[model samples]
Target: MTRHHSPTARLAARMGSGLALGALALGLASQATAAEDYRPQPDQTPIQSSKNESFFGKTMDYIENNSYGRLGVLRFQYYGSSSNLHVDNATGLAAQAFGPGGSDLPHTGSSAGNTTTLGAMIGLYLPKTNHHLAMEVQLAPPLKLDFQVSGDAVDQSLAPTALNGANGGSIPTGVPPLGKNLGTFKALPPNFTIVYRPWTHTLVQPYVGVGAMYLYTYDKDVNNKVLNAYGEPSLYLSKPVACVGQLGSDFNLPNNMFLNLDVKYVGCADVKSRVSNIKVNSPTLSPTFGPVDVGSVSSTNHFRAVLYQISFGMHF
Candidate 1:
């Protein structure tokens, strides 16, 4: 009366139900995968260019530059003047007025130097900014620092007759024509400049700049004839710090090479210098003629000058 089903029938029915459920889950998973893979007919219009592609194209079209290295020649003209006579210590014949001792008495003198030498510069081109802007360091080595001095009249004793104040426009009274070569010295003048190239798109590029420069002298062995007439001679000069203004241009050549022309005006400093070590032998100039004063022999050199330079260079 209970209508009991067989155990085999029950087992087959359960297995069939399990198979249908598994097939349904697999079908759902397949549909989800197809949905993910299907892209709805991507917008019919074309996509806008990306920043990267635009940048790449511009790089090829515009004037693109990288690190710049150059070799140049500098033609320099230094114009300046000197100031008074002074010495340290004591015992040498005073320069005319003071007792056998150094004096600060200002004397007048003018000097100038000129040379043409090799120079070089290396720098990196700033990125993502004005293509024309670059920071550069320039190195110029002067093979010859040829200095010459001339001033007011002097007696046979070589004393400046016209003192700095008494002379005309720094010219002294009875000042003799004292023109002599003070010998050549080596110098290293380094400049730090911000170069501005106005037109880089063209084959020829023009640039202007301002810089801070330093003039340093080395191995300056001077045999001053005037100083030697009195005794032994030696010389010293102040390395000056200056401001420079420059103008230049670069012409492009084959194979990523360039020819450059540059001009600069360097304004130098005004300072006092010393000339030392001499035996004062003239009795007329000093009573203590035979004795030499190591400390008392020196000269004051007040100098302010502008250095003009013309340069040529090659760059890659």
Candidate 2:
């Protein structure tokens, strides 16, 4: 027991003891450093508490880009013009004796206006921080139309005149009267619009537009028919110049095409007419009943609600 340990065993034991002491010293030093770093400093008086303490001075990150939007469109619309009147026959006005019979189908008031139009629309996007509202402007040219009014009817009173020794009754009877061929007119209105987009930059955009319609119309050609109380055939003219309000949606496609459907409300302004008097010479008259001079009969209409338009256009 008194003999000293071998050198190898002593060296191994010394190495283990040195390693343990080094680890213990390193742990103590780290503990001291952490405690010193985390130790609370003297309580200093705090500055006045502000409302935006947590988020104040934070960088408001935003995308940096020029804000601008544009749109070009070409659309086609189908529309018709209409008129209304009451049968004011208080003066015993018969179709044959007084005036021409009702043009049978109410004349459908000539939808034959311009149908095809090249509408060019351009809009701008106002700078908005909340990406919600979008403002735009649009201009569209006139819509052209081609319309005609024609019909046939057999007069019931024509048979009696021929039986009474009259070769061709006082007036041509039974045979349909010559159909009036009213030529076409450029019934177009210049359109200007202001549009607003609620949510933009998406696939489908819903918008509302308000605009003015300046309708352009030429004189309508009226055929010579049996004179009315006014002494000549009568004609009606559709109103020119209207204001419109539209609500619709645009389905934007990837290939620069849009499907637009809108409900349009047109305001009735006024209609101008040019009705001339005609003098008809009678075959059996002792004294020539001179041609009666017919004066102009014109009228302006009240508010009217027209048709709806669904169309397609190209976007550039």
Candidate 3:
């Protein structure tokens, strides 16, 4: 077929080419529309709720970041007795027993006191594990203690003649009463507490803590000479170390305030106490005694435990 192409033949061929290109474009458009319909939507993201939010919230997370700073707290407490204080009457000598020389003869005679105590607490709170946990070291001031003593009825004094050449030891008349005031002193040993408050709230906060408490007392000035009728005027100083354990809750109030109440147990230890006593013989009212050292005061395993606390504080 070597014949030259006619105009009509060329026009027909160009028209066929144009029709094929149009069909291909239509197919591509349709495919794109179908693919869009098959794709996923925007609403399918993960979902979470609010009530599940607990102490594990971002609030406590800051504490883990080493962001906890300085803090201070104050508390007032009223403690109840869990046990009785057993004063060692056998370890230390009474002033009446020690003649003129200060002898350390594993002294005898121990005085017992009531276990209940009421006191105040001042503390400095330091962040250890951020805001979730902290260290609170506090001071409990000298507290007024009520005391009692009881046992087999034994004469407090042997025959006065046993020591003074018998006018014959005349046993003093009248039995001693059940209760007495032991006097007050300063707070030397403070308390150490490890505190944890999970979430800070408006009304109530649940907290857990533990502590080691010590009370160091000053020289007690005993003025009532009637208690020591066997000798002259005197004074005493005592140092007692007690191991303490505690637990409690804090109720936060308005105006940067709060209330703290706690129950605590103070374990007893070996007590070494100092004492001085005096007395005047009949006839010559002149003072016939001087100060003496009564050493090694006896104590037992049971001591004081306290409850109830009302306080106010500012948070940092």
As for lDDT, the candidate ahead, 2 or 3, is: 2
Please give the CA lDDT of all the candidate structures. Answer: 0.51, 0.39, 0.38
Q: Which 10 consecutive residues of model 1 have the lowest summed lDDT?
A: 34-43
Mind giving the per-residue lDDT tens digits that candidate 3 earns over 3-85? 23455864575466447533443332233221212111122221221345443332232222221122223232323222222
**Candidate 2: C-alpha lDDT:** 0.39
Which model scores highest in lDDT? 1
Which of the two candidates, 2 or 3, achieves a greater TM-score against the reference? 3
Q: RMSD in Å for candidate 2, one decimal? A: 33.0
Q: Please, what are the lDDT tens digits per residue for candidate 2 over residues 1-69?
A: 012345586458547745763454333223222121221111322133234533221111011111122
TM-score of candidate 2 to 2 decimals:
0.45
Q: Pick the candidate with the highest TM-score.
A: 1
Off by over 4 Å in 1: 1-65, 85-92, 95-107, 153-157, 160-179, 229-234, 283-315
* Best-to-worst ranking by TM-score: 1, 3, 2
For candidate 1, the per-residue lDDT at 199 reads 77
- Model 3, C-alpha of 96: deviation from truth (Å): 13
List the candidate numbers ranked by lDDT, top first.
1, 2, 3
Candidate 1 vs candidate 3: the lDDT winner is: 1
